[model samples]
Target: MQGAIARVCVVVVAAILNHPLLFPQENTTLPDQDKELMARMREHEEKLEMEQAKLEKELSQLESKQEESSSEDGYSWYFWSTLSFVIFFTIELYRVDLTDTEIKPVEDEDVFSESGSVTPRTMVLDKDVLSNFCDKCMYTSSHENWRVREFVEGFADDLLESLRSVCDRDADMEVGDFVGIGSMFESWKVCKPLMCDLIVPFSPPDPYSFQFHLWCSPSSDVPPGLQGCGKIKVTKFGENEKGCLCGSANMGDDMLCLLHSRNDTPKVDHSPDELLCSRNTPFLAKDQVMKWFQISVTKAWGRISHKYDFEVTFRNLDAAGALTIRFRSGKVIMLNIIPVVQLEDTDAYFVSHFPSDCDSPPDPYWPLSFAVYEKNLLKHFAKRLPQNSCHLHCLQIVTFLHRKQTGLTGKSALTNYHLKTALLHLLLSKKPSVWGVESMEHRLRDLLSFLQRSLQEKRLHHVLIGNSKVPGDVQVPLIIRKAEPINLLRPLVLQRELHAATVRHFTKC
Candidate 1:
């Protein structure tokens, strides 16, 4: 019985050791293997608890970070949306202001009479006022039509101011002067169309003419009509010796008209007859002689003629002389030649005779005659060497004189004398052969020698050197400084030669 009790007690002790929490003393007193098993169970429980706490903490941190990131993104989106709304509202308000601005149609009274009466409707503008208005409108208005009108008006005013400046600068020149005429044409060409088409209300009359009748006022308030007023008349020349009829009259200050045929009345239309007529006379008819005048001026200035050989031939005996000028192809004049001569001084004559210049004077036997001539040798050369050449030659001659006065040598001397002589000889030879042919080569050689000696002595250098304020110590060689002057005598020299030759040829024939 006691042995049975001992075995039961051993089994009880083993169970106690295995159940670690049931008996602490028993577990401590257990064998090494049982103690190690109890230690492993405690370690596993601690690791499981730590793992659960760590996962919970990480999840909480992720939730807080996500909430913060969402708040920042929402704030940025709200700010941009609010800013865009403000910008859109501001642009709408500005556009509304531009659209609401009023533009009154041009008044009829503003255009017609110099009396400040708004009678017949005509289009006119105060250029200074219009320019200012245009500047404001260009930046302020979004309307395309208004913008275009303003831009055009501003451009026209600017052009007019420029023209006025030019005129003021050239106030000393007469209407007959080429420079004056050219300026007038340029101004008219630019301004007339703008006035008729866009700004001015008056129906453009026939071939237009601009007459400077009224003096411009310095006061800004001066009426445009009174500031530059002049009459536009529609006149018809009578048959034979019967003067002309002034049919229609228009108010002044600014006399601008469009040329139209009488048949077309107030409307502007291109009529070949009117064009042809204007080519012969400066009338308001659709036909105008001014067109031809314009063409002739361009041709003369440009030196472009269909007839390659066109020339002026002068024949003189003692105090009296005859001048015949013609333009022709191989041997035919495309148009008639008209000639006029006005004796100015013992040494001078003013000739205005060309189909391009005037109508054939009544009598074919008028002191000056109009004739068509075949292009001959004289005609050929004259046309080839333009009037400009004569002026150039004159300048060269003056240069030669100057160099002769200053006796400089080597490259400088050769440049002044030899080079100039060669150029002068070339010019003279190119001139009509009728001009005297006697001893040109010998004369040129002597002139060159004289120029070289003059340069060495510093005699004529002043003439060639224009207003270059180089100090005397700075010795840059002098050169021909400006365009040569075109004098009346230049053309006459060639004319005289041709006349003499013609006379000799006719007499021999």
Candidate 2:
């Protein structure tokens, strides 16, 4: 029975040694079993290590994906955030401030007067009283007033000095020859005793008659015969009366006597012949005087008359010759004394034939010559005259020259053609006159040249009218077209040209 117990115990010991949980065993003692157990543990450990490695790799991949997603989201957010900030900033910058601010009130007393209510001081500035006051003050303070006063005083002193010099210059004249006084107004009374009583009696009135008599004497103390130094009788509607017979006697005889008396009344020691010789000599001669005079007279008459309608004749007489004046109204006056003369031969000749038939139809040659002279004269004067004066003269010359050119008497075919050509050329030049023959020829040539060039360019061409046998070269229409090479190879082309031929074609249709 002890041997059986020993076997069971051996088995129990073996089983206890093979158990893995048992800690007191030596493992090398069982070779195959130990090898097998070690192989299983090694396999399990290798499996666990591989599994951990795979898990770690998967976690790293997941982390990398998360980080990439976060970076992309951050970039997107930053882009959107920057754009939104810029938009907000721009909106803020463009916004307007509508806030209210305080304003200080203006003081009324600074602009207004100290009346109980506001006075119209500013409005009164435009009033006449204020304006006049300001004007007066300005005038008083200006240099013009002082200058005017100085001029007046100097003029008065100069007049007195000139009179004294004149008296001293003429040694033959005594102090009594010239009665000097303080003023012309005061001298009248002082010389009243020496003055003559010239009585003018009213007479029968007539529409064309003078109605007054004029008388002059040296002193009032003289008797009838001695007082008759000068006497003139102006009668109304009598055959003996030679003076102009106006219907009225409203003016005193003193004023009329001077104008009515003949030049012979102013008698001196020098004879009319000697005085004429001295005065007739001309130092300067001017042909433009009549033009200037006409201009001035026209302007003056234009101001006075209804429409510058009047007739004036300029007469030049020899200083030594007998002067006989005749008026449109059968009044004649004769003078035996000499007059100052500045007559040019041309002007004198023109004046000698006074009141020529200038209004009548002009001679053909005269018109041409006149036109030439007038044009050249105007051009010459234009440089010397003021702008306004030159313009006025130009207008006058144009009117006069136009009249002269159009008012020729002869109307022959040759003359008509010449005039037409001249006028056309003149019109082209756009100058005031056709003045000179040379200038007219030049302008005519220029016009012909222009027309020739125009014809060559097909801009203008002559056409024959009526059934004349003349054949003229008329302008022909030229057309143009636009097409590419490919299109050009096709059938038709379309174009149009502006020409006389087109016009004629339409007219014929």
Number of the predicted model whose TM-score against the real structure is largest: 1
lDDT of each model, Cα atoms only?
A: 0.30, 0.28
Q: What's the C-alpha lDDT at position 288 in model 1?
A: 29
Per-candidate TM-scores read 0.15, 0.14
Give one clash count per candidate, in the order shown.
46, 4
> For candidate 2, what is the lDDT?
0.28
Residue-wise C-alpha lDDT for candidate 1, range 312-386, written one tens digit per residue: 333221101122334354321111111112121111111222222222222111211101011121233345543
State the lDDT of candidate 2 residue by residue for 1-509, as single tens digits.
33223333443444333333332133332355577787776566566556656655655565565434455556655665566566555544443221111122335434444432222222112235333533453333335434433433443333233333433222211111111111111111111111111101111112212211111212323223221111112222334656444324545545554434534332233221221111233111112222322333334333433422223232332211122334456533322111111111111111111111222111110000112122333344345434433232222222232334334532111121122222323342445343332243344334434433332343321111111221112111110011111111011112223333322221111
Worst 10 residues of 1 by lDDT: 177-186
Cα deviation of 60 in candidate 2 (Å)? 99
Structural RMSD, model 2:
42.2
